[model samples]
Target: MRLRVALLTVLLCAATVNAQTWTEDGDAAALLPGQTTVGSGPLTAINGTLTSGTDADLYAIYIDDPQNFSARTCGGTSIDSCLYLFDENGFGVSMSEDGCGAQSWLTSQFVAAPGLYYLTMTAWDFDPLNAGGLEIWNDAPWGVERAPDGPGAPGPLAGWGGSAGGSGGYVIALTGATYAEYGPPPPTGACCFEDGQCQVRTATGCNSLGGNYLGDDTTCTPNPCPPPLAGACCFSTGGCLELTQPMCNANGGAYQGANVPCWPSPCVEQPPGGGWSDNFDSYPQGTVLYNVGGWTGWDDNPDAAGVVDGSNYRSAPHSIAVKGAGDAIHPFTGIQGGKWVIKAWQYIPSNLSATTYFIVNSYYQHGGPYFWTVELHFNPALGVVFDSLRDPNATSALPIVYDEWVEIRVEVDFDAGWLGTVWQYYGGQLLYTGNWIQGAVGQLAIGNIDLFAPHPETVFYDDLSLQPWEPPTPPGAARPLFAGVLYGGLPTRTTDLSGFPNTNWLSGFPFEVDGAAARPDGAVFISNGGFSGKLYLAPVEGPAIWLCNLQYPAEGLAYGRGRLFGFCNFASPLGIYEINPSNGSMTLAMSTGDRRFFALDYNPVDGLLYGYTEYGSPTGLYAINIDTMQMTFIAPPIPTANSAARAMACGYNKVYLVPVYGNEGYDMYVYDLAQGVGGVWVPMTHPFPESQSTGGAAFAPGHVPGDTNCDGAVTFDDIDPFVLALGGQAAFNAELPDCYWRNADCNLDGSVTFDDIDPFVALLGQ
Candidate 1:
């Protein structure tokens, strides 16, 4: 493989304007008095080339001013130039590799006593120190006396050898030096563009095209242009992207002010809302419906457009007709909570050739990472419509209804107690009812709805509606500060930090809870950590229902971005996984790689996923990339005698790690990510809640105390709401239905009462 190298040249401002050019004349001599001269005049540009791979160009230049000696190779063609500076006795003084983008430069190495010097350039991997029949680098720097013999350093001959077969031309720019010979300076060389593309062009032509001219003869083989700087660009919809400032600005994202990576992201949260209903009647007949009214084709392909047909209409004179590869999708955001019903009237003709799809994504990140919540395949040939993602084997027994308008209704309940559930019905008859298939169980959000046709199977859709339904919250199911599985056969428990050192357990769970996460509506999902890894929905009063089974035992569970993330061990390639909140199915979001993560959580404030990997080089907390699974070390490791994996959860700007097996019973550790990276996990200073070992920590959404209005902060504005909450739960719920009434318990005494009045006042003052 030919290594193409580029270089950077540094020229010191000189007084005398002497432009001396020395071209290689019949293989310049390797010793003293070879070809070029380095005097105290101006800059000397050396034009050299390697005729073949075995060629070596040695410029025997004389340096008058020893202190101001600088030799650099920049403009090159098909060459990875390696520059070496040697003393008069042929002892290597200094060598540079890729000093400036693939080129070499020697500026820091000063020549103590400048008499005669050999400035040699060669392709990479051709080591001068080893080719001299001796390990010169091992003898104290690259200082070994060796004289050049010819193009290929023959056996036992002290000269440049091992020419890794590279034929290229290069221009060496020298400053504070002069050469004896003079020739026409080469004008055309490699020009680099901003996109890191190189093209051979003249200095004037290159500058005209806004490209950096790498002198006269630089190769465009290997890209040497420095890459553009990128930083975290945060979006209002809780999305963080790493992009250049220009790109970020173009996309209307707030740049994080520097080249900051997305991990430990500097992004701050904004507001959120997304959902839409559309009827094709508004569009003109035969119009391409793709990219119209937020409805775009799959992957934004304009060719896969749905035509608004006026012939097949269910309620009006228009409906979107999809055929061939036509796939239409309408996206939604922040639709993960409560129960949602998606209704659309579809007409599939009897002449359908292949299958069609009605899909719903739980989480569809702007660019990708689509988690399928519902994928109902309608196979006209098979005369069946089935839920592919959830119950693929069980095709709905109901016969396919064709040639008529049929209402396709899918009811999805993400906040259905613990596990998100979905119900599909076609033409008023039940088709499928099961857990919503998604990455994680905690987040119950739907990203978008897709209508697709695989193979010219014409399908018509009209009058689509995606709306939310209010599901009754189970009694006694209120927000809790802490929820985890107690060790030593103790049931799962819920507690509040408001009472602090004397806080009592709010409720004892019905079953074994190893890992747990809470939905925004205060429903908690707990898991049993064993070989079976059974997961359940822990209701406030009723018995917990078994949801699904996990492949591996999970100690920590987290809820964010409408999904539940788990730290699953007891399996090879142990790492973080997305636990389907509806079915408990697991999808490997990211492998731990080399480290082992014990806990995981999602920070809403920064819109970043966090995990803890103990006992490794990067043994500490990390911000994980959900797409790439790359781990960025953020905080130091949690120091403990027993490094057992535990459950983790996030609240506001804080991350709480639970069931830390310390000298005392299990303790909780809290780390404030707002404190920035390198933050330490400090033991909770307050008194302990549950005295047993626990795992799978969880915090109810918006669980801050004294924030009766649930505005995320305790201020005087909350006084009215706090007074209402103190009056009665029913009255408070009627007024502030969106706010968590438990937040009025400012005293952390686990209840809103007269005792919370003073603490509320204190919080207001603060």
Candidate 2:
């Protein structure tokens, strides 16, 4: 055993020594400019260690033009020099040309196992004027002294001549010196000279001495660099422009100095309507309508049958007035040509049950005529039932007006639908609400016509304004869960029920469910098997009945920051919809798709929606710019194939995902908004242990103070079992025969440890 140990120790030392003596060689004369030799031979490793033979020292040698030595000049101009070293690859890893006029050379030592490696070299020309004249050799010292000259032989210093009287003869040399290395001199305290003088070592002294020397320490008087020239800007004549002092032409042509005293001319703010004017040529006979305080109006030539000034008419609050009337509808002219929500205020005094009315019209050059008009039928007993109309026929008239200002509003979606809501305000109190809905319309008009009365009665109108209208907030149940029914195979009999916690399950196999939406008005919408992707309506206390078969039904299912919005995806494409709790109808409102959307549980702290796709990328994580509708790539795409996102949950500002893929369990990824686009994904290290695969995850709906088991109940039976598990008297495994595993999970974290026991003790029997 002693002999074997000694042999092993000897072998180890030899191996270490052999590893330190590796060498790599290359022809430096063949190196090309800008190309770095990273690794070449099989043994030449770029970023690793190598082992080699004993008694071998590694070194590298290369050739470069002496004139190209801006990096480090070794005194002269010519093609010259070679550098060699052990461990060259370790230190010379970053070799490159120092500068334009500097030779490319590098050397460094390696602290790894030695190895023999070969490097390929290419020829490089530092001197643009002379090329292809340099030659390089390996394993040779540069500028070494040779033996004294003999017959048919010249000494190393034979062709080199020293300065007069030998003052510069070979500066300094230790004769017969072995292993002499040439490098820059040691740093001294700004006093040492190459010629060995302590003082008087300026260019003059070195020249007089005929030997190179370092310059003396003369305090450097910094020469001030010239200041940059001021910039100038030019402007054309008759143009309203501002000019600064520095930019002004001091000689003062049209360009003068600034308003300050330093340059002395000020910039002038040009007056409006000064440099240009409109040239009018003709005037036709018609009422020239113009907007006054941003209101709506009309233009018409009541006399000239063909000269209607509709082309140039402007709409405003105080623009045009109706002088002569005969049930005529004229377009509101010069209304800035934009989609507007028109509103009006009028008054009526009598409670007559006659058909009295007022009409407002919109004329679109492309889609044609559209209108919103109000009708009123009043009686002493029934009071008045007000109604609004869109595209009212010439003969259709109900009842309206008693010489009072009645408030009315008209909303028109350019390509979608039109809505008009009329309200009666009596003494600052709204008395009635009347509304009209038109699937599609174009223009707007406002006027009153006599139906049964002898002539038209004048109704005062005021406070007319055109402003954009915001859609009403959607109303729906707080949370709706649609359960799926599972059918047994081979016989197709109902065996179980599946609650699709995530929405993506709807895309798969022929699973059926009595689909329902819990309504805010205490109603529910259910669907029979008749319509594909259709839903039925039923009151919470009533029977389920079929409603309408919706197109692209999945599009009706939209999720937004903690709220869900449902509407007929195609029929009323732009209408706002909500499940009415009172009747369970998917009621349509006058509002459309112009609201900001976000996913549920969006983090205000990080400004990121927890589970919604920021934008639609295949990558499961979407960072949506809600303001811009731009979705940015967040993390790498989720690995589940053929899966769709179903539900998202948030806790501690991290978003959790419930995707619909096959048996590939619910994988969770955290939203690290801090890790911007293409950032690393942080996987949840500790997943829910009891989840076979996560179907969906959510915080318990209702709070229970001591229901540690999270089974929706709290009782004395939960305490003793939890204590027994905490005392180790019973195992809390899921398969354990007793209920300790269930009762001891007091914290509802799927575990029965100190975490579960402590919470149970605090709220015991509560």
Candidate 3:
């Protein structure tokens, strides 16, 4: 019996040894395939083991075609696995989890070209890509040693809450790639020089030439070199442009050091239009607020000082709170003329039963003699809010919503003085519009704001700002034609529609946009199609604003009637919903029974909402009467086997549709409504890049050359508007508020000036 047992044990040991084609070294160094060479013209099965919970097995492979390569861990015993692929530069190329049940694989398109790469197979919770605050391969250049997030201190990657099981055998199946043989580096590899140039050179040659050597077998088809840094270039006319240092010097503009942006326009010596903004995020919580961070106590009294509170905040973490005898004061400078807007986000707790005042003073001295230009009171006990500056004693009809964040805005036309209007708004709704001063008030300059908290009920304030205000331009105004495309990784590209096929890519977004609508004011409203249902307003000249959520994926968006509307294909009573531009609140405008619209746009010329559908009943180009949810079919369905509909837009008496599939070149179809033929959709030439996933499309209004008066003609009546445009954009906007200034650019040189007189005259002759 003892001899039989000994024989069985020996047999089991031999079988275990035979199965392990590769074994762990129990260190950071990677392992190589034990059975087969990679890229041997066929798939190879490599066996490895995770000896410990922190154990990770990294295999070096050389791929001839990265696109065809596939790696997956199948039938691993007792192992919850994670897989990662990195290029020769150690940058992440692909990652996968759960490709095989409880194991990992790379099934998606790889993000690298043919090259030497690393394939890492780690235990469930181990992620080398997320090294704890260390300079890993993700952040460093080639040849730099990166800190590994592994079986040591600082532990495995954080935030991944997957399986914790570890220490088991793993089987890796690899194809379209080969095991890398170690030796001296390759004779020729891609090298990058300081001037952002790339060339193939030997390791020794690259070192002597002061170039960065990528690795053996590396190629430069995609150009691995980084581009040169760009900085602000200042012109004599106080115009700032961003360009590389060499380009700036060539253009004869003074460079403003490296990496400096042109935003906030550093060329201006003073605050542009004189404004101030403070979110109070920089101040420490519970700190005394006397003479700190441009904030002082009322009447310079230390006992009556406010404190930075963390208990309640709108913007997050911290906000200024005031109670009895805790008054906060913030002063302003260089704010005198024009229409100045003061805004603050206020939060009042539901438990409050006392009154508090938000005061704005025109003439304020430290000790005495304060002229309160505006005084707004919040009284949750009385269930009402009112403005003391209203000449006829204006009060709010709506009750104060406690425990909610509300925007308090006061628009003061200091230029109008006593006759100037004081417009107050709460929660984006106009509360009152009255005299700026009650009776013959003298001073016009805005001096300071006093947070008067005489009662014990605490009131919090955050995200304060004082800046010049401009009224919103009405819809359908002439401006640069722009379009927005949603891409992966939360970056949306805003492209100029006028430069289609060679479009100018403007800004990036922070979230994945599912639908977009371009405004004539050079702004775009974007929505997320995900279940989160978020919408955002991104202006060309200002910061993006979170408007509101629609509670459903908005498949398309359009701007018309001075309001934003979203099309929802999959919602209860699915159809279009009218969205308020100011607050993002929405209401169902109409319902489309049994019809699904994939994309939507509004034609200003016809005053109809244009809708498009790729498949299903009523599939074609149609016009929707938003008031009644009725659709008018315009054109029959077109071929869509090679592509799918992405977005739709209407302008220039035409309807445009963008179709895409698998990153192929961008193809568009346009239907001229003026034809009324309902013929096949005509293809238009455009230059959209290949492989980018498109989500939405929109059209910004463009000006007609020589139509300065915006009367839709090049007649003699446009002469005066053209002359006013020559004075400057501000002057033209003031006199011809409804006219597009760029219409005066008859020469199409991007400006209105004396040089355009000849072209203007030619248009007059025509």
The most accurate candidate by TM-score is 1
* 10 residues in a row with least lDDT, candidate 1: 1-10
383-413: candidate 1 lDDT, tens digit per residue: 8888877667754545778898889999887
lDDT of 2: 0.29
Please identify model 2 stretches exceeding 4 Å from their true place.
1-552, 555-563, 566-619, 623-633, 647-652, 664-700, 704-766
The global Cα lDDT (0 to 1) of model 1 is 0.63
- Per-candidate local distance difference test: 0.63, 0.29, 0.63
CA shift at 649, candidate 3, in angstroms? Answer: 1.9
Model 3 lDDT per residue over 1-766, tens place? 2343344344434432222222322222333331112222222555667667776666666665467777777665557667776666555566666666776667537545665766777776555533443312231122222333233223333222233458867778766554454232336789887546688876655774578999977988888989777777654223345556765665445689776755334554355365678777888889878978768788778877789989889888899999889789985533554688899998887877677888897645455445677788776767767886663254453468788889999998855632467888888888888666554332445668888888778889999988788532111112333334455432233344544544433322233457877654335677875766777655332123455666667888988756688888767788888887544566788887665666788776666898877665757888888876678888876555554666777765678777754246545677888877476777654323443555676775435788776544689888888888889988887765534567777786655679999999999999
TM-score of 2: 0.20
Whichever of 1 and 2 has more lDDT, that candidate is 1
Against the hidden reference, what TM-scores do the models get? 0.42, 0.20, 0.34
Q: What are the runs in model 1 whose C-alpha is more than 4 Å off?
A: 1-246, 249-275, 438-442, 471-642, 645-655, 658-766
